[model samples]
Target: MPASDPVTSRPPLPAAIIAGTVALIESAGPLEDQSELVRAHGAQATRSAQFMERAWLLGERLGLPDDLSRWRSTIHLVVAALAVLVALSALGMSRAVVGESRSINAIAALVTLLGLHFLTLGLWLLSVLWPGAMSGLSLGRLALWLGARMPGERSPHALTVVRATNRLLQERRLLPWAFGLISHTIWALAFVLILAVLAFGFSFHSYQLSWETTILSSEFFQRFVQIAGWLPSLIGFPVPDPVAVQHAGAQGLTALTGADVQRDWAWWLMGCVFTYGLLPRVGFALLSYLRWSAGVANMGQPDSGDPYVRGIFARLEALDPPLVTDEERRSTHPAHTLPPRGPGIPGTLAVIGFELPPELPWPLQSLPVGIEGTTVLELRLAGAAAERQNAIQALGQIRPWTLLLVCHGASSPDRGTARFLRETSHRVEKSRILLVEAEESNRLSNSASGLRRWSDWLKAEKLDAIELVAFPEVGQENA
Candidate 1:
């Protein structure tokens, strides 16, 4: 089969990327290696969107499927089922304790089922005010885990899928937003179902709902009921009068009666659930979804200053070299000009020695007989740790001009040379890998192999060109 176009070639679809990421996780590979690929590819984009698209393409090429609708549908079904189960449990518990009673305690029921929802809302609010307080809630991880374990033939790959999904989420930085959206949505669904159950129960069975307190007077209870039921009353739900309130709170079996006021109490309870419990949960769920959507959008493009984006741009420039224009600029200080070269002197070019061979005379005190006019700006060592640092610092101070980096033509190109070239390339106008011609035929290897090594290294470093420089005669010393 033909390979897909590279990710950098065209824009990728968001859904494709989302599905692709899941596919990437499910692909056969160690999670570490898979994650490393993501880190490398993901770092190429400045925006989350761009990163996601490219990552999706990479993932697809790595065997991730292009379609993820099945997984998405399955997860939604599972989440809904989970919400329903929670609602059923709460309904069963609420009924076990309160259904048998002639009258239900409205305060107790509200606090039991919906109190946690309110607490979570408070915490969410706090997270906004003081960032990182609730950072541990990784909803994306939960969703990915749930998706991985969703029942089917796919269940066999659950653990690996989970690991891959996690690594992808971490690479994309989408955990918190995903977590909030999923969890809040689940809570919203649960609360809605719980209220539905309450509504169904009330429609079929008659239960007296009231607040009774032995320590509190009928007046206090009446005022509280009136206040609490005020909002519900606006939408045509019945609110009990002072007389009914007193009757309901009279605190003995004698005070309880099967009256029409029971209808009022039930409506008021449902109204409270709508106003206090369901509405707030829905609102929170919606808000979280909005934030998650915004986060998804942000994944496409990131701030310009992000280091990962910059690094990718650097690599991209190497792959498709951009036209470099020396734009006009005004500076207070005079620009540095190259020293003039006579016929005997080489042209005005900087010669940087990279692991200069000991046999070759140091600094080429004069340009080789044939190569005149080039000045030896510096002699830098490339291999050893200490020398590498010194070379980098020395190179940093050199003027921006044509740089001819002198390398041992016999020795093959290595990482040290690559690193030196990569680091110095940024500061210079132009750079060329100059392989030094051997003094004797005893050179460790032929120039062909050395050139081939440099070619491969330059390609890896995304460098465009290489050059060769021959050694002068035996006694051509600087004089």
Candidate 2:
């Protein structure tokens, strides 16, 4: 967008953007984990999320709502309907340009993206301001959208997942004083990983659009605009291009929205893996980070759970863990503690914080070998319990390690590591160790400073060797 564009003064987004943002929220982690809360709240939260998603579809596919259907009816409904129509019409103009224009040059692309964004923005406002007029939006709609390719039985845990996540956010579980920002940060970094792939395909690679250009390619770029298309892309933050001005367009959007855009195999590959899980992780991270940086502290107290605390908790419990509830706890069972932490610790930490693991069939050892360290333990655990046990065994009788970094979950990308740190830290304050989690696949740090980026509170508290673990992938084991 030009400096003087009419939208310059508009907030950070347009009409479609709002809807895109809301769509992104549907399966997002910090919120998806709210499924736990849904369980606690029965299906209210789950239903609510479902409702939003479905209502979005309804708006997109169906039309306006009832009271309006009746009163052409209630004043709010009537106005909302008209506002949506006008906004959607404006938004449609740009999309129509893309859909109609024979030219696929940069200018056209820009106009197209802007148009779609406005449409989405209008719908988004309608949903937020006149939600009652759009009550049909929901997860059930998503199920329908997935259509034939839909996964198996829906986990009834959606709502509980919400509750659990809310619990973590409320508790401010990850970040600052924690380890294994791995899972939590995944949501944010996953897109980065996807971007790296696209970049590798086009931007940084010797080539321009092959393997590296996928994320920023034509298909991906337009999707970045369309509400129906933008969710995963936005969640990923997968840059369209590297340069902002010059040829890359508003920031890097130019390169992304540039001419001859095409959706190739690489784009689809990244989209599938990243969208299903990684992108949602990124969304949650943003939500948590938002709360953590500003929202959490504003609560005027240290004890209140940050918005992400509940999310993290839900993620951990999703592991089907061998958890001992307060009721199940006995005085005799010894609690597991972490390795001690201190100022001079040698281990360094890093995050290859990107989207999905390298494409399938990429051997573990042959996969990207990020920054180096004295000890490199590649954890390819299938589930959280396996990872927890591995954590214990890895640090159990080990030496004066300088760093501890974990690989992303070996299977699908749904597992979250941030939740693990939060739950564990609450009950154990031994040896004193800090935890930080991230997505992506690179990071090379010595063991010493790893604790530093982790947290002073944790270090000062003298916690034990922290175990940063991730939950299991709930979808197809083979998918």
Candidate 2 lowest-lDDT run of ten: 1-10
The list of candidate 2 runs beyond 4 A from truth reads: 1-332, 336-339, 343-380, 384-386, 389-412, 417-479
Find the 10 residues in a row with the least total lDDT in model 1.
Answer: 337-346
State the lDDT of candidate 1 residue by residue for 1-479, as single tens digits.
Answer: 11233333344334334434544453544222222233333344333333344455444433344234445566678677766776677667557435756557765675676677677767766655554566566344455567766666553234543454455444565555466666676666666776777787778776765565668777887787788788878877787788877766664223556556676777777787677777776776677778666655544343357554454445433432234455464444433221221121224456777786667655644443344344536665646767765654554464435566777776767656666665555445566655565474322234566767767666644454544444443544343
- Cα lDDT of model 2 by residue, 299-362, tens digit: 2121215333344334433432245657656456444333332332245322222232443221
Residue 378 deviation, candidate 2, in Å? 6.5
* Number of clashing pairs per prediction, in order: 18, 121
Each candidate's TM vs. the true structure?
A: 0.50, 0.19
lDDT of model number 1? 0.56
Q: Where does candidate 1 stray beyond 4 Å?
A: 1-57, 61-81, 128-131, 137-177, 214-220, 251-258, 321-479
